[model samples]
Target: MRSVLVTGASGGIGAAVAHRFAAAGDRVAVHFVSNRAGAESTLRALPAEGHALVSGDLGDPEGARQIVDAAAAELGTIDVLVCNAGVAPSEENRHVIGDVSYEEWTSTFRRMVDVNLLGSANLAWAVASRLIERGAPGAIVNIGSRGAFRGEPEHPAYAASKAGLHALGQSLAVALAPHGITVTSVAPGFVATPRQEPKLDGPAGDALRAQSPFGRVGTAEEVAAAVFWLASPEAAWCSGSILDANGASHLRS
Candidate 1:
């Protein structure tokens, strides 16, 4: 079985991704930052044994390295690295241009970019390095967002970071292909995770649903499925591509 490392596997899409891999008989290292209980729960819910739980702050470069190293050590070797941890757009970190102070804008941007972009970059580097050293073929799938293509006015940092992540995946796809590694990214839009329940049940619910012609938001499992396929051997030729799981909510020309 291939060893998989899924960051932010405490819940939502990350948890679903872990479950997906485990269901396929792959050993998974479920990684979390602040949600130990949730991470444990995810580990317990896995269909198979040999899964492990790891924790670290993705915002810290050294912490990112430790996370990958821990996962690699636990799972024997990390053949698949899913960079799913990210700082989502929330009220506490909201910084609209005109409404927020310069400090808020800069701090918010730094925090988002550090965790969302640089964190993934660090993990990719760590995982790819090991695979190269061992001469093993591997896959790295990054969980990006449709906001990268559409826009996130209230959370411009989030958009920029995801855009950078998509670019990073493409660059790595080219750079790592010679080493028998594949890199790809998935851009999901408006997934209905527990954290987003309030937004879905609030007044903005209808508007959010209407964003897609299907008249509904996405599910964590759906996103996970896309991630799963992208990391599979059948999709090796799809490296450097960004698959959109937005249900037509947003399209790119």
Candidate 2:
């Protein structure tokens, strides 16, 4: 069985992705930033044995390193890395260029960029190094967002950060291909996770659903399925691809 490490695996898309691998008989390291209980729940939900829970703040470089190190230590060797830890736009961190204060704008941008882009980059370095050292074939699947291409007026930083992640995967895809390591990304639209249930049931629900021709937003499981395939050896040739899981919400020519 493959050893997989899924960051932010405490809930939502991360949890789903972790479950997907675990169900496939792979040992998974469910990494979380703070939600230890959630991580434990995810671990318990896995289908088989040898699954583990790892926690570290991706915002800190040392924490990021510790996260990867902890996962490798637990799993023996990680064959797949799912970079899914990231902060989403919330009422507190919302920064509209003209609506929010300068301090708020700067702070929001800084935090999002640090965790979403740099954090993923550091984790990738640690995991890719291990794969290269062992001379093993593996894959990395980054959880990006449709906001990267569709734009996020109230959360420009989130959009830019995700866009950078997509670009990072492409660059790494080429660099790591020689080592039998594939890298790809997934851009998902609004996903109906527990945290998003309010928005989905509130007054804004209709507009959100109308974003796609399907008359519904996406789901964490849907994204997980795509990530599952991307992380498999069968999809090795799909390296560098930025697969869309937006349900036609935002089309890119």
Candidate 3:
């Protein structure tokens, strides 16, 4: 079984991804930032054995190193790295270009980019470096967003950060190929996680859902499934690809 490290293991998507690997008999390192309780709950929900928890703030560059190091130290080597931890600014602070304040824009962009972009890059580097040094083949799956390709009027920062992550995945795919490391991205549209339900309720939510050709939002488990496939040996030839889990919502007319 492969050894996998999933960042943001405290949340819906991250936890689901961890469970998927664990259920498949792969050793899983569950990484959490502030949700220790939630991470523990996820561990309890999983099948017994072969899974452990590691906590760190991905917003800090060093945090990514610490997480990967700890997990590697325990699991010997990481076969898969899932950079799934991320954050969006508060609704109250959501901004458009013209209306965005300096502080709000900088802080919002920094928070998202730090964790979503930098953190992912840090983990990718750490995992890829180790894999290269040990001459092992591995995979890195980055959780991107459909918003990366589409326009998000009030969430420019979030969208931009995800866009950057997508680009990073492609670049890493090429850069790490010689090392036998593959990097790919999974971009999910409106997923119905607990953190998203608040915005996905009511008329506004219904309207947004209607925009999708499938006329529905996605589930965290569905995205997790995609991650599983990307990390699996079956996808060895799928490096640098951005798999869309958005139900054709952003398809061109």
Question: Each candidate: what lDDT?
Answer: 0.96, 0.94, 0.88
Summing lDDT over every window of 10 consecutive residues in candidate 2, give the lowest-scoring window: 89-98
| Model 2: CA > 4 A from native | none
lDDT (tens digit, per residue) of candidate 2 on 191-221:
9998899999999999999999999999999
Task: Write the residue-wise lDDT of candidate 3 on 77-170 in tens digits.
Answer: 8999999998864577597777877887888888888988998999898899899988999999999998888867798878888999999999
Stretches of candidate 1 off by over 4 Å are: none
TM-score of every prediction relative to native: 0.99, 0.99, 0.95
Per-residue lDDT, model 2, residue 196, is: 97
Using TM-score as the yardstick, the better of models 2 and 3 is 2
Query: Which residue window of length 10 is worst by lDDT in model 1?
Result: 89-98
Model 1: per-residue Cα lDDT over 1-253, one tens digit each: 8999999999999999999999999999999999999999999999979999999999999999999899988989999999999999998888898999999899999999999999999999999999999999999999999999999999999999999999999999999999999999999999999999999999999999999999999999999999999999999999999999999999999
Q: Which ten residues in a row are the worst by lDDT in model 3?
A: 88-97
